[model samples]
Target: MSDATAPQPFNKEIPTDEEGKFRGYAKARADFLHVRLVVAACGALIIYIPHSWHFALITVIAVCLAEALDTISLNQSIKRLNSGAPLRPELRFSLYTAAFQALLFSGVVIGGAILQPRVTIDMFLICYLFAAVMNAGMLLYFNSAATYLRLLIYGITMILIISMRWMYFAGAPVLAYETAATLLLAYIAFRVIDFVENNFREQEQDKVNALSRQKSMKTQLEVYANKERHLLQLAAVAKHANDSVIVFDKTGRITWVNDAFTEITEYPRDEAIGRRAGTILNGPMTSPETVAKIEHAAATHSPLRIEIQYYTKSGDPIWVETNLVPLPSSPEMDGGMIAIERNITNSKLRQSELANAMRNAERSERAKSEFLATTSHEIRTPMNSIVGLTDLLSEHDLDPAAREYVVALQDSAQSLVRIVNDILDLSKLEAGKLKITPSVFEPGHFFNKLDNLMRPRAEAKGLSLSIDLPDDLPLLYADEGRIRQILVNLIDNAIKFTRSGGVTVAVQGARIANTCRFSVDVTDSGIGISESGMRRLFGYYAQAEDTTSQKYGGTGLGLAISRHLAREMGGDLTAVSHEGQGSCFSLFLPIACTDQSLEGIEEVTQIPEAPTANLAERTILVAEDNATNRMLMSKFLEKCGAEIVFAEDGQQAVDLFCAKQPDLILMDMQMPIFDGVEATSRIRALDAPQPYIVALTANAQKDDRDRCLKSGMDDFLTKPVRKVELLDTIYKVLADRPMMEKPLS
Candidate 1:
């Protein structure tokens, strides 16, 4: 470590006390460097005259080198302290080096005395040693290790010098006295070094204590400024907020109110300040229960949130949502409550309006259902008499002219029946009351039945009808009856429009994942729909052209109802057509498919005939209110070789059932004096042989059928009942009726 290469101060502004002390010590050493050099140089010169110059030169050079090493160590120690490194090891090393430098000076002095025996202990050497010790005590006083070690080294050297002089110069007169003065002077120098070191340490400690107090005061001032800024911001926000805010004491007397509070309640802040909150805000509309809840929360110092209706100064109703919280207690003031309220008058009005609208919609739907049911019964009752009388008239072997008129009458009646049914179905679908009953049936059997039904109509129109079915068709899971109705509509439309060419019905199906996706395409060679018609074809009461309804004579509800039913079954209905070409109406449906084999399930391809020949000797009890329907039933049953007894209403039917114990009762619902449902219930209550009861009525709504079956009727059939259907129903019941034993005549 040379003088030129030694590190200087880093010029970093370290505000801490430890760094300040280290820098001060380092500066002291640097400032006294010239003094130390001059003292050592003078000592070396004094020794030069007494001893050999070579010995003095060697000793001075060694001392200069030791001083340079000590200066380098001091600079390095300051650098380490600034970097936040521990200095215990550096301090210990510095003490060892300083002791070494002291020992070198002591050696120089002792060697000069021993080599030049003619000269005794010199005063110049004593002054030089004392100057060196004083410089070291000032420079290194901050480090106790280095300062104490320097004192110990010099004290031992002084004792050794005294002992050497006392023994070697025994013949001298006051040599002993001179040694005592030397020892006393040495003791005074050591004490002065100790006092300078102690005083310097005390001054450095006071500076450190003062720095800590200054830092603490600066921190406290910053905290106070932040608090003042926060309080100002809170005051501004409260004054401008849109929600009403108020503060009140524990006794419920208002302390303060915001601008918004005055705007919402139409009460001035000055008047509200000292009054209880409830008296100013609560009005005739405010519920006592809600006020009680607010009081309870304030009494307990708890939080509360509620919605209450209030009236303004102008007597207009307002709904408010309030949130209240208890303020923390303090020495300057008792704890208080703070509340924030928002106006919600518009929200409350909207909620009430929505409830009223829903109720009106429900009432309208119920009225529509009742109207459809009543209209169906009224229309079908007269149509039933017309249809029944026409059938009886046709069987009498009438003339050809008369027969043609009867045929036209029957076709018109059937068309009217179809129209009524379509309207009922559409209403049920629109009202969301249609129910689907799923059953497993063979696709082949279902299509075969459709073919048998539509073939006769197609042949009459001189159009060829063909059906194409897949060879590996799976058994379908769906509402078999509804699907049949949809297919019937499609095929009937096809037959009605075609003049010359054929109608082709093709069914294609595939199993994908868990569903069977199938399409039924009913294509006809009749007039096709225009492009404009396709857009509105599925809408209610719509047709392709205005003249089509007049020429074709349809209600135009079939397609709309079919599409609604298709979507309800999780499928859709669509069509493709051209104006001059034919149209293909495709019905696509997805039904649940299974891996169950269809190997041995029998298909009923032939339509069952009513076994009218086997109906002979069967006694039937007919319950009917209409005089014409009674006559028609009697005549029809008598023609079939069966005995019939008639009752005018439901109660009479029950009385006849107990007396006659007939094999079956054809019960009519909606009759006078307790309907068929009640009559059936009474008949079932009787312990007599329990004859089969069938509901035969013009009330064709689904609910009507459910009511009849629920009252213990074995079967239900709606009017105007066809001859074939009525005969078939009775034929089936007769076979089951024999199981109920009839008493012998």
Candidate 2:
């Protein structure tokens, strides 16, 4: 048979729309059969009457009508099923069949009552037995094998009922037949209930299986979708990665390369794959050590990092930082390494350029030092002549006009000295030779000294200057000289910059936990710095880009030096300013307590009067390498009541010290033959009384002081020294010494 016409298995066949219609028709036929049987049984009730023919006719007519009604109901049910309506049509047909059967039976019984009652009753019982069998047989055809057995039992019940009817008519016992029929009916009812229960349970199991299959299908679809999305995201990341990525097997054969690798190497995927890693990429510039490291990583199954030079397809050498990570092994494939390389050529070039720039900067710094030294010497030489001439003029009798000119010269010389000092201080700070010496001093006493120094300058400018100190401020731990220099620089800057409003210096103490902090705030109505200017204000040699620099000339190193000094003394200086408003600069320093004995040391209450011209009695040893500086020092000391002895260098001074045993010895720090530190060491080694040793060196850094003290020098004094500083230092050292041993008298 062709596939379209072939007989299929019962389970495989597609249910036709006509199948339900056919079932409806079959049920209707069964109902009709039952009705005909019931009608025939009723006809038996009128069979023996005197008017039996009329009763039989009425019974036949009633039976025909019931069968016709049953047929109509069955046709309606079939029509409903064909239209895809509910099975309730079949149930209505069954009920109609039962109702029609009862009507037919009733017609027969009523018609029989008009004839003979006894014969009619006897006929009705026999017919009922046959009709019951026919009804049960029809039920058997449509239902199960059990239903067929029920039909046979119902046939036997009909026989017993017929027997019971005969027994009643023939005067025989009826109990046995009636009891047998009742038992058969009960068994059939029980079997029907069992079949219905089994059918529902099977339907429920099928539903559960269907639902489970649907859920499993949905889960598989979701997993597939997720996997597709993840693959797409990975492709995007690999395509856009900035670093070159290449995967290779342990045998060195390239397996894969990302888009960056292709772009960087200028090698297409087809050209690069299956080639040895070193063959295509590595060139003369590539390091053998780097290749060896990669080989070691592949052998040991570890990660490796190395920087190498590689030539691109365009023949440009690029520096690359490469990382090789070993892939985990799998059953289907051998382990390999994934190489991620980043081009660092630009960075490498920048580093080389920076190194060259640093060398140039160092050379420039050295040249600057030499220039400063030469310039300082030359300028001081002229300054000495000018000052000396001014002093000589003051002594000589002169007119008011001539004396005024001399006074003007003196003021200019003093300004030049201040500028030169600021430059020297800045140089010391830049050379990293500046050092801090912590000293215990009363805050009140320190402020008093600052006031004495600044009050005159403020009064000259006609600007109010006030110093405010907290009463409970603690002693400061700092280099006293450096602190004073920082304060003077800040205050001087405030005074010089301010034209109208006054300048104020306020001192306060902050107690935090175990430490006391001392702070100095300097507020001035100066031409304040702009936002753009403030950024570079603290920078070396930087000045405000306004009228301030043009109007009030300065070296621009004071604030920078002050900030450096403050930081060196374990503090910091910061400023707040507005363009048109005033400015406030604050200095924060850690404070300590003053020792009692040190406090008892009497303050110098007065500037000592200059001694008379009696240099014939006093001896001064000058240590100087420069011939001009040596001559200048001798002349200056000769005018200060001392006879001079000179040494060209530190070593000469040491040798002359033991022979002359002069009252005081001068030391120059930087010398060719022997530096001041070494000469002082030799001088200190002598078993004689330690002479008064003083450092007179061009190196004015605070480290110079430490070096001097370490060498057993009694005091430190910078070169190109003012006559006042030199004379004051000499007199103080002499006065501090115990009275010189008197000769035996």
Candidate 3:
């Protein structure tokens, strides 16, 4: 009944309307089979029909034609519906009236066959029984007018036939009962078909739903494939990036890497993947601490941007700035970091070079300072004797010619001492160990003292000396002693370089916020500097000209030392000069000022007399390693009326002091056998009066003086000792000690 477009295998998941149409199609099929069954029974029953053969044949032909028409109508409707063509509801099945009329005619025809005369009891039962059996299929195949209605028509017709043959069937009631039993069997079959048909419909629906889901899944797979293609494009970009990129899994294994990673690390992608990132790159140069740090970051899920050492596959060391970023979501890797590295080996090399240069420069500077200090100390020891002997010779009753030679010799020794002192000062500045102490001083009185010192030298040179002190000048808080040194150097240079013109000492002042600017200008009207000469004027060992140091008699360090000292005191020293004209060297000091007067300040005015150790009363130990210095001190002390005892080293000094119990000990700090400090401690430990022990060494620092005092010394003095200054210190020490009462008076 299905057309060409119909499902060859019946579509199981039919809609409610489609199921009705399908069942109607089945009914049309059953109607055709049922009509054939009835027609065959009609022929078979002809023997019982006797004279109604012609009537029976005509009745069967009429029933076949009617059923054929109704089947044709149902089949055409099903064909249109299955083909997805328009199917009118009116045309889908035969009019219900036509269907019922066909059934009525079939029933009439069946009744005629059963009721005809000459039908025996056996004949009636077989025809009726065959009709009921054939209709059984109709009950299962169609929902309407098949099993019960057909059986009722047959049963009622037989009962009427049985009444007509009452005389034949009256005694044989078994035939009637058999007929009733056949109708009952047909009703049972109807219920069975109806029950089974519901289960069949549900199974058919499940199959259709499964096919629909399969079609949808196929579409989804296509979309996923397109997304996979896009990801491949992103991978191409990563493959050629300059920086090395690698991804790690949560367990620290490499899951993916770009082509640049392989290029920089000298390992291929296949070899790198599945390997621990740290283990693969961690060679001898790579620190274990770095690996542990990376592992810790992974464990804690942290990000890192730092530099670390890495090695190539061939074991060449290099530096890298590694950047680790956490991969919160990635299909290939679990939660982990992606490390990007850039090479920085060149930068590391440059930094290493700079550090080496700095260390070398420091070492060279230290060596220079040490050499200068040693040379100064060695020269001072001998220089002390020459100056002292010359002074002694000058004081004696000598001839005029001998006295004149002694005075010239004294000048030479003093000049040598100044040069050595300048070298030591320069070294101290370079070593960053020079100490400056600021104090308040009366500018007018300080200038008066400087004037008196320089006036005689200027007068001898036939040059005028002038001092200009400003009345409004405030008391200056500065290193007064260093200031005096600078002023003296400038004034002395002015006097030494000038042949005819005068030297002027000018002091000027100005008020700055919370401070005063004091400019002391030593302007000399002689031998001026040229433009090129001023450029290197304040540099180490620099002079106005090459011949300036030789001709003017200087070590060429005074100006350099002066400049550094001025800056150290929060000021500067600068020069302004013109060729053949006078040079003005300005000493600028930013003073922490005060308005205090100098009324109460007392000056030491008493003439200083050298200490006298009465020969019969006092014994003094002189611990000096140098023979010249020892002889010089002995002659000076002998002149002072003191008996002299000599020791070559600290150990001998201790022995001599213990045995002789000297009234005083003059200790030299640096000696071979035992240093002065140890010898002084041993001498002070004796059960006797701690005689005044004076430290005389070449170390001219305040810290050195403190060290001597802490070691039980009574007084401290520097080497290249001036005759007057040395005598002054000894007299002061002896006068203060109770152990030397007679010597003090």
User: lDDT winner among the candidates?
Assistant: 1
Q: What is candidate 3's local distance difference test score?
A: 0.70
lDDT of 2 by residue, 246-278 (tens): 889878789888999878889898999999778
- Per-residue alpha-carbon lDDT of candidate 1 for residues 1-745, written as tens digits (9 for 90 to 100): 1121122222223223544555665665565566666556656766765556787778778767777667777888877877887866666766777777777777776677667655644554555555555555554445556666776776676666666766777778777677777777767766865676556656555656766677777778778877888878888878888988899998889998899988888888898899998876778879999999999999999999999987776777789999999998999779989998898888888989988988988898788888888899889988998898888888888898998788768777877898999999988887678888887777888888889878867886789999999988787888888888888888888888787898999999998877889889999998888989889988899987778899998999988888888888888889999986888999999998755555533423234577645656667899999999998888777766666889998889988877777888899898899989999998888877888888889989889999989999999989899787888778866865574445566
RMSD of each: 8.5, 14.1, 22.3
lDDT (Cα atoms) of all candidates against the true structure: 0.78, 0.67, 0.70
Model 3 RMSD vs true structure: 22.3
Give the lDDT of residue 127 in candidate 1. 52
Give the residue spans of candidate 2 off by over 4 A: 1-232, 313-315, 365-414, 424-439, 454-483, 486-552, 556-620, 635-644, 654-664, 670-693, 702-715, 722-745
Return model 2's CA RMSD, one decimal.
Answer: 14.1
**On a 0 to 100 scale, what is the lDDT of residue 448 in model 2?**
85
* lDDT string, candidate 3, 369-464, tens digits: 556756766787787778878877877899988876886686678678778878778767866878899877878778888888788678867999
TM-score of 2: 0.55
Q: What is the TM-score of each candidate against the true structure?
A: 0.68, 0.55, 0.60
Predicted model with the maximum TM-score: 1
- Residue 745 of model 3, lDDT score: 20
The full ranking of all candidates by TM-score, starting with the best, is 1, 3, 2
Sorted on lDDT, best first, the list reads 1, 3, 2
